[model samples]
Target: MTKPTLPNTTSSSNQKLPSTAHSPVFRLRDMFKPSFDLWVISWILGLVTALSMITLLMVSGWFITGAALAGMIAVGSHSFNYMLPAGIIRMLAMARTAGRYGELMVSHNAVFDLLKTLRLRFFNRLAALPLVQQRNTLHASQYMHRLVSDIDKLDEFILRVISPWLIASVSLLLLAGFIGWALPLSATSKTIIYLLLLSALLLPLMASLKGIQSAKRLSQVSESRRQKLLAPLAIITQLLLWQQWQAQTKSYIAQDDRLQALEWSAQKLRSSYMLLIQWFFYAAVLVVLFSIYQLTDSSTSLTTGVDVPLVLAVTLGLLGIQEIVVPLGQHYLALGNSISAKDRLNALLQPSVSEAQANSTIPTDTETGLALPTGPLHANLTHVSAKIPGALVGAKEVSVRIDSGTPLIIKGPSGCGKSTLLQALAGELPVQSGEVKLNEQDWFAYNWQDQLGYLGQQLDIFDQTLAANLRLGKPQATEAELLSALDKVGLLTWLQAQPQGLQTPLGEYGAAISGGQARRVALARLLLKPRRVLLLDEPFAGLDNETRERVWDSVREHQKQGLLVVVSHHEWDMGQCDVLTLKENVFID
Candidate 1:
C-alpha cells in the first residue's frame, strides 16, 4: 500500500510560463474596441454598481452610528428613543441590501459576456491556424483542456480578481477621502496607516506562491500519468480484448500510487501557506487595534464630539476595509494562476502562418486524365506534399486537377499518401512546394469552406441525432433533400427502422452503428452538401463487399454534378472513369 514518490517542483517554475508576456491592459484595450463597446459598457456598469454598493454599506454604518448616539443622549425621551433612529436604521439596511443584490447581478452579467467573447475569439484564432501548424504544434488532449479548463480559469480571473480589485480600489479611495474630510487628523493618520498595512497583506500572497506552483505542477503530472495509464487501457481494449481487464487493473494501481503521492505533496504545500496566512491575519488584527487606540487617545476632543457610537461605526467601517485587504494575498495568488492560464491560451491564439513563406502557395497539375479547367476551376493542387506527424511523408509532388462533372479515382496501398493528396485538394493540407487552386483561383484567394466537401478517413460523428450529424454537412438542407441523400446512400431504410428515426442519437463516434452504416451516414452527408468538388479519403475502406459496392454506386451516381476525387485500395470498377495510381504517377492502368 506504500505510495510512490512524485517529483516536487516550485509552483512558479511549474507554471507554463509564456515565451512572451501579454499585457492584461492590452487585452482589456482590445476588448474595449468599437466592436466590443457593449461589453466595455457592461463592465463599466458592473464596476460602478459594485462601488455604489460599497458606498451604500459605508453610509449605512454612518447612519446607524448617528442614530445610536442620538438614542444615548435622549434615553428618557420617548420620541428620540423609539422613533427616528429605528426608522433610519431600517431604511439603511434595506438600501444596502438592494445595492448588494444589484451589484451581484450586474457583475455576473459582465463576467458572462466577457467569457463568451473570449471563447469565441480563442476558437477563431485556433481555426485560422494552418492545418499542418496545428497538427505539429498541439496535442489533441492539451488543446481540448485549453478550450475548456483554461476558459474556466479566465472566468475566475474576471469575476474574482480583476472586477473585484477595480471595485475595491475605487471604493477604498472614495471612503478614505470621506474619512479624511470628516475627521481630518485621525482619518489622514489611519489612511496612511492602512496603506502601510496593505503592503503587509501581500506577504501572505508571496508565501502562497510556493503552494500555487506545487499545485499546478502536481496537476500536470497527474494529468500526464492519467493519460499514460489510459492510453494502454485504450490500446488493450481495442487490440488485446481478453487480457485488457487484468492488465488495465495493474497499470491503474501504479498510476494511482503516483497520483496519491502528488496529492500528498500538494496538500502539505497548501497547509503550510494557510498557516502563514493565519499568522499574518493575527498580526494585521494587532496592528488595527493598536492604531484604533492611538486615534482615540490623540484626539480626545474629536472622540468626545463623535461619541462611542460614532467610534464603533468608524471601527466597523475600518474592519470592513481590513477584511477586504487581508485576503488580497490569496486573491493575488489566484490572479497569478489566472495569468499563467491566460498566457498559455494567448500563445495558442498567435498566428501560425508566415508571410515570407511563398512555397506554401505553389501549384501543380493532376497526372490522371481528369480534365484540368480550361476556364475557371473549382479545385486544383500543384506539387503539394503533406507530412502528418507520426505518419510517413505523404504525396510528394502531388498535382491534382478537376473541374465540374469530372470524377477521379486515386488507388494506392495503405498509407501510400492517397488521403494526404485528397486533403491537399481540399486546401486542408499545407502546400510545401506547390499551389492549390479552387474555383479557378488560388485556394487561399477566397474562402474554400463552401466550395468543397471533405470526408476524412475517420468519420467524425458526434454523439447526436442522425439528422443532427447530417445537418453538420449542410445546415440549410431541406427535409426532402435530407431524405433524398440518405436514400441515395442506402441508409434511409435503416435510419427509419430505428425507434426514434432521425431523432435517435448516434452513440459516441457512431459506436452504435456498424462500420458500413457509419460509412453510409458519411456518404449521406456528402450527398447533402452543395459543394462543387468532393474529396473522399478511404470512405468505403472498412465496409463489407456488398456495402462497398453500394457506396461506389452512390459515388458514381453523384459524380455527374460535382467533381469527385476518391482515394481507395479496392479495385473499384469506375467504368470509363480516369484512374490515378500513386505508385509512380496518375495513370489509367
Candidate 2:
C-alpha cells in the first residue's frame, strides 16, 4: 500500500506539477496519521470514563433500593450486610472521578498536539505559493483571519463529533445488556428498549445531515461579517473627518444583524434536535414503567414477576443514558463546521487553472540557467496590458524599452496603475496581452527572480535589532556593507542618534521608529543585496524633500550598471532617466 502524501507545490515555471485535487476527507485523515496513538489513548480513556459513570449510577441505585427494602423487615436487615455494598460504592466513586480526570487530561493534550500539527502544515503549504499570490493584499488579510478560525474548528471533528457518538453507543449497549440480565422484562418492554437504542444510533446521523448546510453558511457569514466590521478601521480617521463615520457604523450594524440571524438559526436547529431526543427518551422511560406496573399487577407477588429493586435500578440507569444521548444530537452542529473548514483549507492547495495553463507554455530550455547576459542589462515591454487580479484599472498597451544607463521612472496619479506596471515587470502580475522580455527572451522564461529586487508599498519589517533585520536581504553581509546600505537610504543620522546604534530593536513592525525611518530601514535592507534589475514603488514616501533628494542620488548611483524602474507620485529632478506617465490606465510617452 502506498502512503498518502499531503499537498505540495513548486515555484518552478516548467516543471510538471502534480495535481492537488486530493480528497478533503483524505487530507483530514492524513493530519491524524502522526498522532494516531494519542487519539486512541484519548478515545479509550473517554469510553472508560463514560461507562464508569453509567455503571456507578446503576450500582448506587441498586444498593440504595435493596438497603431500604431490607430495613423494612427486622430479620432481613441483619442478612443484608451493608459493608460490601458500601465498599463497592466507594470504589466506583473513585473510579468515576479518576477516569474523568484522566480522560480530560489525555483528550486536551491530544487536541493541542493536533492543533500544532495543523498550523505547521498550513504554514508549510502557504510558503509554497507563488510570490504574486502571497503578496495579494485582500487575500493576505482574509487568509490570516480565516486560517486561525478554520484550524480551530477542526478540533471538534475528533472531540465532539467522533468520540462522543462512539462512547455513547457503546455505553448504551452495555447498559441494555445489564438490564436484560437483571430483570425479567416482557416482550413489549424489550421491544421498547431495542427501539430506543436504535433511535439513539439513527437520530444523530439524521440530524447531522440536515445541519450540514446550516453550519456551513454560518461559518461563511460569520467571516464575512467580521471582515465587514474590520474594513473601516484602516480608514476610520478619514471617515470621521468627512463626517461619514455614522454611515460606516450603520453598515457595521446591518452586517452584525445578518450575522446574528445566522447564529440564531443554527442554535435553534441544534436546540430543536436535542429537545426531540430528550422527549423521545422520556417517553420510552414512561412506557417501561407502565410495562413494569402491568407485570406486577398480574403476578401474585413482586418477587416472582419482577424484582422491584432491580427495576428501580434499571429505570435510573435509563435516565442516565438520556444524559449521554442528548449530546450526540448537539454535536452535529460542530460536524458541519469541521467539514466546511476542511474544504476551505483544501482549496488553498489546488493550483488555479490559469496559473497551470501559463506554466504549460514555458519553454523547456529556459527552465534552467537563470544567469543574466554579459554587459549592460536591458528590458522591453511590447504592448503589455495588465491588471491586478481583482481590480478594473491597470496599465494598458504599454510599450517601453529600458537600458542599464537610462533608468525608467513611472509617473502617475493615485490610482493610475503605476504599481501594477512595476508588478508586471517583476512577474508579480500576469499580463493580459502582449509580453515582457528580458534580453529578447520571454520574461517568465528566465528564472531571474533572485537577480531582481522588487519593493511594494508595504515595508516588510520584523521585530528585531537593526543589524539582524538588515541581514535578511543578504545573510552574509558584513558590518561595513550594512552601514553603507543604511547611508544610501539616508538613515545614517537617525542610526547615530539611537543609543544602541546597530543593535537597536525595531519593535513589532517597526513601531519604535518614525514612518520615514522605518521606510529608509526597509530600503536599506533591500539595497544590501545586489540585483540586475530593481523595481521600487513609492520609495521616497514619508521623506522630506532634502532627504528624498539625497536618497534619489544614492539610488541612481547604486543602479548605474543595472536597470531601474520606479513608481512615484512626487516629481524629481530628472537626470537622464526616461519618463512614462500614466493617466486613466493608459501610458503616454
Best by TM-score: 2
Cα lDDT computed for each candidate against the true fold? 0.59, 0.76
**Candidate 1 residue lDDT tens string, 1-589:** 0001111111122344333223232253343332354444545665455444444455566666656656766765555444554565566556556655665666566667766777777776665445544544454766677656776666655555555556556655665565555542555555554564454445544644544565466556656666766667667756466656665566567777877897776556555554554554345445545555655656463444434444444445555554454444445446545655666666555533231132232222221212323343456666666544455456767666765566788887655677777665555555445666556555554433344577886677889988888887788888888888888877777877889888888889999888778877887887775555677877776677776787678777775677778887778565766677775333221
Reference-based TM-score of each model: 0.68, 0.87
lDDT of 2 by residue, 108-225 (tens): 8888889998888887766555545555622677777677778888888888887888888888888878867876778778888778767866888898877788888887777777
Residue-level lDDT for 24 in candidate 2: 42
- In terms of TM-score, how similar is model 1 to the real structure? 0.68
Among all candidates shown, the one with the greatest lDDT: 2
C-alpha root-mean-square deviation, each candidate = 10.3, 5.3
* Lowest-sum lDDT 10-residue window in model 2: 1-10
